[model samples]
Target: MISKRHADILKILDSSGTVTVAELANLLGVSTETVRRDLRPLVEDGAVHRMHGAVSLTGPTAEAPFRRRMRENAPAKQAIAARVAATILDGQTVMLDTGTTTSFIARALTGHRRLRVVTNSMDVARTLAVTGGNRVFLTAGEVRPDSGAALGPAAVAHVLQFRADVAVISAGGVDALAVTDYDPDEAEFARALLTCAPRRVVATDATKFGRRGLVAVVGFDGMDELVTDAAPPAVIASAMAAGGARLVLAG
Candidate 1:
């Protein structure tokens, strides 16, 4: 038998499809930490899916729903974003990939003095577009409504025009062999960015470790840097050593 709190959580997730940790905490008259603890079992039981700071009834799939992903592990993502933003030089061109972590990076880049950003994420483009001293370019392609990302042959072509100083992308997983993505089109776009930039940087949280997606975007051997909230597993560490990729831990 489940606890009343667990039952309530399931009820909420079922009705709304998704809810944030803070929202659940508030509604349940508990602390955020408590809500997190409450969610672990449900997640293990496959009764709930935990995104950054949010929860949903659906289990982990090829792609997490966008809103839930944005709220999932938000603080860790922010930390990773700030680290990614700090390394970018002023007035340099950057290729931004589509993902919640990259969206946070876009927000972090708002204070940068000058930059040229080419991206397929509508969320990323919108976040930095209005910021002063920044030039934002949005790719043309079919937009995934939930993710707000443009991905297709047209988008890949648009991204290929710029030879960026850095390519900051997000990954569904960073395992021993490759960096992967849930969507094939998104993976293709990411690979295009990787080829166009000398510095290939992947920004993702620790939760992404060991999780593989439907397609591989780039192999571990091709990565230049990885920014994350925790130290990678031994397999990843070994791969990084063999590939000469630098790992940046945000915390």
Candidate 2:
């Protein structure tokens, strides 16, 4: 489904055939950033082709980046973290992927002790380290400077060697029916973790609602549960259900 802003912009263009980002932003009383962001999904969806600062949707649609596309949805992220934390069993081995949403899980896990954490996330490992009283194993791999997470052939291999009771993976995007990521290595790492671990969970905010991008990380069919802020829209809810995921609505 097209975003409200995207739809509105498209409506205005039916009469003129095209509009610039600046004009759309000014007309909509929103930032150019917002306008550009709205256009990106259309470009990815092939609904509209973006030319310079302008966009036009003719047919179909492309995927949008979930994690990076929507960074400001803090409330949804926190709620998802709370739900993810609630799923942990005492002393259960858990693996968390590298993402801001997963970091919130680390914070929520502060009170838990003696839990085994297998992770490639420097921030997550550091958080557990300072918290004290946890059996955390840092994965051996190359760290991606931007995400501050370890990933590589070694990381994938290392993650695959372990078996955990639970694993929480995050992503950069999702479509009407698939889960995906923008970084190929991150996708590979997450998939490897899911493969080795038994019970799998996905943590994502609402902004990841409806889009697919880059590469497929894990299909919806693979997740045992999906922890999100609330019951998402009809499309998202249906997709997760179709995959047989126990949808956990947090907060």
Candidate 3:
């Protein structure tokens, strides 16, 4: 499903460099009532820039394009990416998921001499291809235009054929028992990916720390490690740790 918020954010960023509530409403074909509701959290989270009557991403008034939203918090995401990169050992068969955070890790891994990366994300695959010298494995299936990852039953079956040393996935949110995502196909595809990889690592930022998105990709008990920008809510973090999952705060 195409979320109105997602569609609006991406649309506004694409047409105008940055936009205000009024401008966004016009660009996104929505009402000011709906525009303000969508812009509130994005502005607060620093994902978008806001001003009296205009908004943009480059300057104080600019907002990040949807595709680059997660890259905005360089310090926090780099901290998280560093730890994720450190976890990769030479010659390990790793599974990388789609997300800005994971994409950062893919670029950070320049030192690893020998390793195979199996991923459904075109961006991650292309980024790693730049660093040079690693076996990059792309799964077989249809790509999802909405989420920027490979999906469909064929993709799930292809992932099941291999056992990864570690699978690093990005989440839209984290709840008590499950990982969350905006789209059901992406969530289901993620579930199948996790089942194929015995050791699972979740790569998410502080913004996704406690929210529950549309679907549960997997539960806390299913993870081997949870890597984030900050310490997750103590109670939830502890519960995850108790499940034998290591909870590491990068930022």
The global C-alpha lDDT for each of the candidates, from Candidate 1 onward, is: 0.85, 0.75, 0.73
By TM-score rank, best first, the candidates go 1, 3, 2
After superposition, candidate 2 runs with Cα above 4 Å error: 1-71
lDDT of 3 by residue, 1-251 (tens): 22667656855675545344555666677787877777676668766665444455533444334454544566777888898888788888888877777877887776786778888888778876655477888887888663367877877788778888888888867866677876566677778878867788888887666666667887777888888877778777777877778888774
TM-score of each candidate structure, all chains considered together: 0.76, 0.72, 0.72
Q: Whose lDDT is greatest here?
A: 1
How many residue pairs clash (N, CA or C atoms closer than 3 angstroms) in each of the candidate models, in the order given?
6, 9, 7
Better of 1 and 3 by TM-score: 1
In candidate 3, which residue ranges exceed 4 Å CA deviation? 1-66, 130-132
Clashing pairs in 3: 18-56, 19-55, 56-61, 56-62, 56-63, 57-62, 57-63
- By TM-score, who's the top model here? 1
lDDT of 2 by residue, 98-217 (tens): 988898888888878778999999878988866647888889899865457899999988888889999999866666667777668888898888887779888887666664556788
Estimate candidate 2's alpha-carbon lDDT, on a 0 to 1 scale. Answer: 0.75
